[model samples]
Target: MMENIIRLNFTKGKKTILQGQLNWSNRSADSIVGISGISGSGKTSLLRVLAGLEPEVKHHFRFNNICYSDYQAADKNIGVVFQHAHLFPHINVIENLKLALKAAHHKAKRGQANQVTSHKFELEQVIDGLAISDLLDKSVEQLSGGQKQRVAIARALLCQPCLLFLDEALSAIDKENRLEILTWLKTVNREHQLPMFFISHDSFDLQALADEIISVNDGKLISIQPIELSALSMGGGLNRAILNVQFDHHIQEHHINAYRLIEADSLKPNNGVLIYAKGVKAQSAITRILVACDQVAISTEANFNSSMINHIECKIVSILPLDETNQSVEMSIKGSASQMLYAQLSNYSIQRLDLAIGSRVWALFKLSASIAI
Candidate 1:
């Protein structure tokens, strides 16, 4: 059976700053939808509206075929983490996590023994996954910026939210720790199947993490494009060009000795192609192929029922949450050929198939799904 997922269509903001209808849908169970724009472009405002942190003048938000009012959204099991780790200075890390858990429990129906045990297990899992079991005994004020941010994330996860929103959650940490935390967050999302919506000004982060990017201008959604890695032609030459391509995280510099150029039928940017390349190896030649993450699917077994042509047994290298609101999964898959491919699937699928790091899976994609760069 197909799930209705989430469908949102609405407008917000009275002034010209943010006054346009935004239509979005999450067909999958998990997604990471990214919103990017210049500062003051109302990126944060849109997130606040969706998360019920800010009021919307006009809005329609629906999830799983159920329409939710603003009040309902406000009470929804949604977790949010901001740029700063706003932990209670007077409290210790464990206390903060316990407080969040208690609050979540308090609002729910009377907990049974099994439910309580389940919650306790989940809490322990989150604490350990975030690697904050040791830090739990430390005071919030005594922790470093990175430690505090991890605790904040752990607190949010302890609530067992249906949706998680991160508004520059890693910005407070130093560059090295920020990246480490990001990797940990990916692992958490994969194992927990928690959907997330992340806001960032860093193009690299968005490109590396997001499945679908939402570009906003003046509070209006200007473009929604899949994040595809492209091999750009670097050197200039009349007959040949040097193409810098990245595959399996390794840069393979290709000199296009001879190739035919085929312009795309449609007038879309980044829609042209090199018909053929002679000098590059056959396996590495497809490095110029731009594969949309969403077009590729992952499964525990080979999809014999489907007609998708490109099927490769792959190892799950990493799984990152693309958009939590949609419950999307962005995974880095390494084929036996040492080629790296990105596949996007739902959190439901990940959970159903029991996919995890180092798990062997089949990456399925159609030949037509790949576009020449």
Candidate 2:
């Protein structure tokens, strides 16, 4: 038997703001695909087209060998969470979700749609998954930016759509809440076998959720590849890596986490890495963290007494100049056991350390308030 897949072919204005060809396939029914590009480079245009929101382009959406001819035809199977939560302002949170549930039920009865790996969602489960159980009676106007997003996501779940499209859907939320919600979404994808198309300016968000990422550049599809930090092509963006970490506890309610990098290798010091973040919960199921290249510092010897908690022994793999005329350089440093992390330094610093390929050194990292995700 063949594996399941979703294929999309779309193009707009022979010389316009958007052109795209995206294909999603995997052995597992659940997969998250990412759309990324620089602003004005057609990222949103491509995403809107792929989601069938751009009706001017002829319909070209397929799932499991079944095709939907138009946006209306596709609406039944697709649920979109926009950048802003578009809930009915007059209704309270529960009312909004109930409305979605009722609409989905009506659609189910009328269309009698194919099962097609669809997941049935309960109101309780939706609210619980999004942690909106407490906000049921609150009106939409009373909710904060993050709370509104959670409600919006919960409403989408109630529709029981086979596919989900997230358009920078969680941008308004704080880092801690965002991570919590992302963790919950990962569970949703795995347990319900639901697929998602994710779009965000933040590469960390893409790495956190996407399985495959499609890069759009200057109004055309540039490339498609498996999701990784290196696959980020937003042009002149920071280099980053995502790591699984264990959260020991919050220190002094200062919103700092006693975090330890999990599976980082024997090179990582036993002391591990701690992060200074706001709104972090001890119970936060945060499994992945984004470490920026700028956050890492190179040292000839591990500094145990420094305020920076994370220190790892790594060998310099490669050093390249950002610009021949500029003194700044970037280094690819590898852990003793696996994978490379980056550090940015000046020419003077490189000369002082006399670092080179295969030269063992330490990479010090500090997680700031906004980097927990």
Candidate 3:
């Protein structure tokens, strides 16, 4: 029954918000874990319990070989970013940051220096990374919702936590800033080997960041699985395909970092497709990918002059109407090993390209859409 790599028997509440065991054995140290659930489903409650805020609930818990008592969990130097920014109203932004640094330093001075397992993050680096330099002089009360979130994020990173927990922390920020911070988070996680548990209601955040996602319902863990776009409950979301993917690690080419999409492990070696993505790393052993079907463009021949990276050779299998007016159609194509993928194109472009059911063509997608998750 305890087959999971880290078994969890948590009783977060008396009536039990989470009265179940977590079966997560495939998790890696550097993997970003996502917690997803509805608004009142105890997402934050679970996080609070794990961070030692709800120590009473954790008394009955024993996780794998390690059992964190209230003191250990509370004093483990875990960093957390809450949904609502919890900045001190009496202090300015810089003062708030200084207070956090001071606390971390005091924790270190308490003869617990060995607890700092992750990389030591510098204050200036975190400020610049989160783009919070301008707001340092302003009081916490004067900042907007997004600005406060940025500073809160900065404060958490400055602590140099071994484990980080984000409880819908990015929900208040705009899309652009959220993406920027998420990218930085991934970079820091890889460089310093920081394991993170990010909680968000947005599937896009989970898809872009989480190596594996844990689903929750009625405050109970429903499942823990790898990133699958279909498993994300993206109904009426972007059209995509899950294909058996094999890629070589990221390498530099003409001053650009990219990954080479190789054929399946069973296939012989050949010149592979090159894709540029921010999330690609050589250490990642990803074998499958979720391809945005809308981003896929079909062509009779490979066109490198255009910026599109993927040029997969496949045979057209079938075409199905997308709408009542038939302005567009969803086309299916088979690559090596009979792997099927989809592309949504307009009727005009299909005729313009002279694509046929059995004709061979190259599927083209941009460098940005090559997210392995």
Candidate 4:
């Protein structure tokens, strides 16, 4: 079980939207937790309460394993982003980012003064990673819907908070922009290890990003489900098969050991593939990765002595970052059409290379270093 950053045990308002049964325990501190529920289900209200943005509501809240409130006030680090862009139309992009950092800085403890300065450095790095360096002076009114959202994301991250709340922040964007933002969000969550609370109504949106799907209706939380594959098997076999993957952890090589017998008719087809391996572990040679546009770092000059084993020369297509905290530098490699790889790097690196959206570089990684399947 995971320890949650916060929990709720009290009711809100006259409607009795949340009856006494809602509870989430064992939540990791730096997790990208998402909430999916229908409209008028109080998702926004829940976010407000957790963030301490709304104090009138009755509830119990905790921060970093310490109880904050059972209707009592407790100071906690929190950053929030609403559906709208919330950018000041008169302010420029970088100026907006600085404002967000200043606000978060005020929340820092008196003894932790150095943390505020360090956080400022991080904010600059985050802004650079966002790839809006050239647009720093561009006013908010000059930005498009997508661009505004990107700035908003950077502002949220610049806060350097322990917990973040996103209340359908992507709802106003177009489809292409929405997809692009989702990829960036995934990258940020993995790279920075920031825990978040994402509220949305779309199932497809949740499927592409959520570690656990929690459904809410009329203010009540339904059961949460995690996606998993049960087994892998072949067609027309009377007995079901279980793939036993064996690998050398030290050498980083993998092989199939054998298969176990089980009942047939348990398999189902999905999108063209029929078999699923849920809990089975593969040999060390194979790697499983949750893709992040930021993690795929590329360099124009390839080096032989570096630890990177997976190196591929690619043409730069587009480099995007939701905000300064998590940047996505996209590249188009040869022979792999429409396929791209990302390298997660700090804002400093993004500026050090003076990388443009279309510059050529070599994407590098250690094949053995990624998460093993």
What are the root-mean-square deviations of the candidates from the true structure over C-alphas? 16.6, 5.0, 5.9, 17.8
Clashing pairs in 3: 5-25
Q: Please give, for residues 116-216, the per-residue lDDT of candidate 4 as tens digits.
A: 12123276566665556677889888887767777787888887765567888777777666765675565566556666678866544554555554555
Which candidate number would show the highest TM-score if scored against the true structure?
Answer: 2
After aligning candidate 3 to the native by TM-score, how far in Å is the CA of 226 from where it should be?
1.6
Local accuracy by lDDT, each model: 0.56, 0.68, 0.67, 0.54
* TM-scores for all predictions: 0.55, 0.76, 0.73, 0.55
List model 1 lDDT by residue over 1-373, tens digit each. 2232222334434455554544456534455666677878777776666676655445555543434333444366677887788998888999999988886775465432112111222677777767789988898888988788888888877766766788877766776666556655654554555667788776545544554566677657565554432211101111111122322221137333322221122212222222222233233321234344566777788776876655656677767665662233333333122225666677778788888888888767653211222
Backbone clashes for every candidate come to 11, 0, 1, 18
Query: Which residue pairs in candidate 2 collide?
Result: none
User: Per-residue CA lDDT of candidate 3, range 162-207, in tens?
Assistant: 7788998898889877876776777788788887888988776766
Candidates ranked, most accurate by TM-score first: 2, 3, 1, 4
lDDT of 2 at 53: 72
lDDT of 4: 0.54
